[model samples]
Target: MVFQCQRDSWARQFTTQVVSCCPAELQTEVSGKKATLQGFHVILEDTILFPEGGGQPDDRGFISDIPVLRVTRQGPDALHFVQKPLEPGSEVQLTVDWDRRFDHMQHETQLFIPGQHLITAIADQMFGFKTTSWELGRQRSTIELDTPTMTAEQVVALEQSVNKKIQERIPVVVTEFSAGDPEAETVRSRGLPDDHTGPIRTINIEGIDANMCCGTHVSNLSDLQVIKLLGTEKGKKNKTNLIFLAGNRVLKTLERCHGTEKALTSLLKCGAEEHVEAVKRLQNSMKLLHKNNLSLLRDLAVMTAQSFKSNQPFPPHRKDGDSEFMNIIANEIGTEETLMFLSTGDEKAAGLFLLAGPSAMVETMGPRVAELLEGKGAGKRDRYQGKATRMSKRAEVQALLREFTSHQSTEE
Candidate 1:
């Protein structure tokens, strides 16, 4: 069944009777979070809302006072999912979301038609690249050309050629033919779907290109406003995906870029042109400062180790440091017979721990300390190290080390 939307893309409202209504669920996003919408899949006798197909999203609108969440095509039927169910035989008014519909038309017709046509033509004629595939994304679209790589000069040329065609204001013509008609073979298409039984529709960009498509389109190339090629990305084996924006999308992208430029200028305390240089200088300065800080920490570790009492259990705790710093102090002290437990970080939060002593004693006490500190660790020889969350239990760890060392000394 050809939907009223497919027949008249400009239609905003239609009077239709509900053919069937069944409980259904729609997965959608609210704010930035995923949500499941409980609704009724209502099939109307006829509708002005376009169902999701051909890389385009479904239309959002309302059936009477009930909000229509989504529309999807089930074979020949256009199913309208709504929050509230209408009686199967009841008559209802279907209203399309015009703003959203027009935006989609701009993206679909303006971008898809000219973008696909011009890119494919230019790549084939100039670079001998063949069109492999294309995707119509909500924000941007990509046309993959069968090429290993694309140069900057080639991208600029493609953008310029597309915009030039838009300026020409070429008339876009839509023609339909019966499925089995010999005239259908004259149109350029990948191929008709196996289940495609409707009349074959083709969009002709007056004297430029012709291709079979089922989605709605603009009547003229001028409606596209402008095309912006956002450069190209490496796609699957031997393919280059050329990404682009058209119509209002180009304007929106420029607006976002300008806003970002202003924000960067203010944060960097520099003009827009100098933002890159300023950020580079700032990064270099940070690297130097970080290098100096590490040197000072190593020096402090050496001094603390020199004051260590020999042949005793020493538990050194600090406010802020890391595993490397703890290891530095242990290395300086020389853990031959001295049992040392080194920890650094906030008492209220998380920290690092290093236990060093005789291999036998370290193996025995490592598990005990790890369990108390609420952390796991492994060690070989005479050292054990890992991260711990319960740094607040420092006092308990100190006691455990002290008792174990004292008992060993008594037996010795």
Candidate 2:
């Protein structure tokens, strides 16, 4: 049946009789009464819900106070998916979600979201540049301009030009045409959809733009309040996505951005205007401090390694040739002559750096240490280095290394 939504974009209610409703699923209510509980498609004599179309979302609403989950187009009818079923031939009240409907209507304004319908359309008419595509967000919209060599200066110029037109507060005009009308085909913004036939709706923004469209829109450019271009992002096909804000969204974005700037200023200990430079300076200071600390750790490691050099035993070839052992510095914890266990990390986790006088000791104990950490270690030049997960087992690792060295000494 012909629907009110198709003709009157602002229709909010309908008192209709249910032609048919099939329950997609059934459930028992608290009164043990069977309830379809939504997911069922219902057909009414007529509806005010605009089904999903023209890249816009479907109308969400209530029928008989039950939620309308979704609305989709089927041939010539609008199908409303509802939570509960209504008896066929019964009368019901259908109400549209006015807030959502008006929000969509706000976005459809030529002054709010730039497209082939606003000053962008004028750009095409005046120059070779135009919007190739557009996207609408909750509080923002993006229109991809078709110029490949467009500059930042040019984008600013375009924004100023659009804003100038908006300040004029031009009235928007709607024109209709019969099927396959030559005038409808002449619209600059977009072509007809696949199934569009008969009457064609063309939107005109005074002398600026004229385009084929089905979405609802504002009556005047002034209702948009103002248009604020956020910036541009590189788009597909070398186009540029022009981000913008309008009306209530412009104020909302400004409020949100101010809050973010305040947070950054506090974190960097700087004024709002100086936040970026202050953050950069703080990061540089942190990098310098990290480099200095690493240098200190390396110097300490070298000193520790040198003390172990004299305590370790000489290779078999060196000992066989001379029959003497190198002397190691003695300490309460360990001396390198037999073994030295060095480690790093904190109470929760650590790593092991083991140096042994005899190669045999490193080969035998390294695997056991690795298993304890569920990790791997490698040995080279009498030093075994690897990460250990069981940091609290530092004493256990020392005991194992000691036991291995003692066994090798006994064999000798």
Candidate 1 residue lDDT tens string, 1-412: 5678777778999998999999999998999999998989999888889888766678989999889888988877888888887899999988989877866776676433323465566566677777777777777888888888999999898788878888999887878888789988987777866666667887778767787776767778788888888999999997899898888888888999999999998899899989889999999999999999889888887777876754334636777677778788888887788788988887767888899988999999998899899988888889998878998887898899889999999999
lDDT of 2 by residue, 1-412 (tens): 3356655666788888898897664243657775545368888888888777665667889998988877877766667887777799999998989877766665666532236667567556656676666777777787778866666777687678777877898887767788767777787644655665457776788877776666666677776677777778888888877787777777778899999998997777789989878878989999999777666545544454465455533211111111011112112224344565555545346544344444566666667777765556787655566756665766676677667767767987
| Backbone clashes (count) for model 2 | 4
Model 1, stretches more than 4 Å misplaced? 27-37, 97-100, 110-118, 307-320, 407-412
**TM-scores of all predicted structures:** 0.87, 0.67
Q: Alpha carbon lDDT of residue 298, candidate 2?
A: 51
Q: Where is model 1 poorest over a 10-residue stretch in terms of lDDT? A: 110-119
Tell me how far the alpha carbon of residue 402 in candidate 2 is from the true structure, in angstroms, after superposition.
9.6
Q: Cα-based RMSD of the predictions, in order?
A: 3.2, 9.8
Q: What is the lDDT of residue 288 in candidate 2?
A: 99
